[model samples]
Target: MGYGLPIYHSHCRIDENNQMFEEGREIIYVNASIQEDTALGRLMHDMFCTDSRDMHYEFLRKRVSYYKENEGGKQEMCEIWEEIKNKGKLEGLREGETIGKQAGLAEGKILGRQQGVIEERINSIKKLMRKNGYTLEEALDFLDIPKEERSTYIGIFTS
Candidate 1:
């Protein structure tokens, strides 16, 4: 006799003669399908019949529109919307930070390689000057180092 008890049948035949039981207790079945135009029927139809994402989204949109028009449950809707927005923002920031770290590491590796190459060139130039008895000007000219960049190379070699 309790409300919301499910109806079971022995066969597929559905009529006034069909009886259902739950835990050996007979349950009463009220036909709500007769009032399919009611609000509850429509809500059930949208929930059960809608299969596609767009259809479900549209159903939710209409439900929200109804709630807004009736001025019902505004506070709950606002809180849910805020939670969804904050979660999206947090996920975006996390993804952006991950991408930034990857790019920064790649750039640092490139710069480190470039520095290593420059250091190797400086060492070669210094060796040419000391072991080959070449003067600073000769070493600069032999290595094709410009006059403006000579001071930096000289400082690295001397120090």
Candidate 2:
């Protein structure tokens, strides 16, 4: 692992050549610290970024910004959690019983957790709206929800 520069991606292989055989195994490692000018270096830097604003790549930064700064992005991330839940379900099922049987069990657990977070936020918005006598938009704005993502919760916000 190397740190510094804007970003980089780590690449690993058994040897310098493109041989896939298990022979003359020579580990190849390209230190990111020295490869700061390369694309991989930038990718590595992007991976270590804690905040979207700190990211070096516009593509990665924009995507992260969508999830962090936008409320719809939050919901989108929850859906991603559900997808991971399904994949995780598949993984655990591959270890035990038939894939179909255990699929729902594991997937739902992750989905439920994500949904719980979404539900909690929704409830908070509702609570603020009722207690503070705020409109839906005002309540969402008060909670720092991004304007672009506001339309996503319109229906749910009403009922």
Clash totals for all candidate models: 0, 12
Residue 89, candidate 1: alpha-carbon lDDT: 47
- Expressed as tens digits, the lDDT of each residue in 1-159 for candidate 1 is 314423332334335867543355443454443335566555445555433332234757576555554455674565457546545644564566557557875655555555556556656775786589787778889988778888866654443
Each model's lDDT: 0.57, 0.65
Q: What RMSD does model 1 have?
A: 25.4
Q: What is the overall TM-score of model 2 with all chains considered together?
A: 0.39
Error of 2 at 147 (Å): 39
> Where does the lowest 10-residue lDDT sum fall in candidate 2?
2-11
Q: Candidate 2, which segments miss by more than 4 Å at Cα? A: 1-38, 90-95, 98-159
Tens digits of per-residue lDDT for model 2, 69-150: 8998997786567556544644563445344336756755555565555556667776786589788888888888777766
- Residue 71 local lDDT, model 2: 92
Provide the global lDDT of candidate 1 against the true structure. Answer: 0.57
